[model samples]
Target: MFNTIEHINKENRNWLKSFYFIHKLSFRTLWARKASWVGTFIFSCCLLILFPFGLGTEALQRADIQIGTFWIMNEFVAVLTISRIFSAEQECNGMDLILTSKLQKTSIIAGKISFTAFQIFTLQIPILLLWIIFYNINSNILVNLLNNLFFVSIFFNLGSASLGTLITCLTARSLAKEILLPMLFFPLQSGILLASVSLTIHIGNNSLLGAFSESAWWTILIAYPIIFSTLGILLSDLLLQE
Candidate 1:
């Protein structure tokens, strides 16, 4: 019993260390390619700007249109960013190195998902601000819905990032990853995407309490991240095996 407990503790420590190593590597890669990330940020902003022209300025006044535009732009920028999770590693066979190392596969997946989720969350900040500015969000509405939006965005990022990272890993070796990714990702994303959009619309129209009153949307928002994260963890060993 003591030996088993010791083994478990040692494994936990190793997992923690591996998770930290991957996160640090991800940060360094992000820093090294700062220009690319900046360009993605700029491109997302441009996409946000362009939406108004196509939808007409008046469309922004409608909550569904406003939320829809934000989510659509979000999906696009997120796909662009998430697609790069393994690009840097693959270029120099870094993933190959990691996969063969002593590090735990589950920890590696966790680290990647955490970083990707954080990165996407960070990127969403400016777009969300611009969204508010571009649409001239009413201060009262913003204040009333601020907490709800914050939680909704967190759930949104977590679900999408977990699923996106997993899908990216699954397609990492494919010759047609770019084409395959969006085809697989976007369709799978429809549930969380629709849930988030609906939650946003509800919160915007009905506040957090009111949104929670709609049990179905609330359930999807909560279940999405949990489901995808569990799937990613459970499959990491199989996915990363040689």
Candidate 2:
């Protein structure tokens, strides 16, 4: 019994160390390549600026339009960039290095998801600020706007992040991954995308915190992240194996 307990504790310690190592590595990898995503963010800003033309300046001046535009840009950017999370590893054969090492597969997946989710959030920040400026969002709406943005990013990102990992691992070695990723990812994303959009629309109508609690948004927000993140986490080992 003592030996079993000792073995379990050692395994836990090694797992925790591997987790932190991979997490730190994810940050380092993205930071070194930060310009790639930052450029994407700038591109999004330009796209949002042009949006007033098609959406109509007056129509986009509405609070709902502003909020919707922010998340819609996020959804678009995520779809475009999600493949890169693992593509880097595959491109350089980093996966083989990892595979031969003692690192846990789930830890690597968690790190990728963490980095992707955080990247998605970073991508939204500039667009969201531009959103507020363009819409002339009042001080009264600021708190609720930020609140919903924060939570919705979390919920929306959970699903996207997981989907990002699942697709990356599944397609890491594929010759057609660039073409295949969006096809695979967007379908998994549609339900969460639709849910978050509905939730955003409800929030746009303004009932503050009460609006979230009163509608199906809360359930949809809570359920999707849990379901998708779990699926990604549980299947990661199988997905990453040689």
Count the clashes in each prediction.
0, 0
Q: lDDT per residue, candidate 1, 133-206, as tens digits? A: 88887676687556777887788888888889889878877899899999999989887787777777775665
**CA lDDT of every candidate:** 0.82, 0.74
lDDT of 2 by residue, 21-67 (tens): 76676666656777658777877887777888989888876767777
Cα displacement (angstroms), candidate 1, residue 162, comes to 1.3
Superposed on all Cα atoms, model 2 deviates from the true structure by an RMSD in Å of 3.0
Identify the candidate with maximal TM-score. 1
Model 2 misplacement above 4 A: 206-215
Q: How close is candidate 2 to the true structure, as a TM-score?
A: 0.88
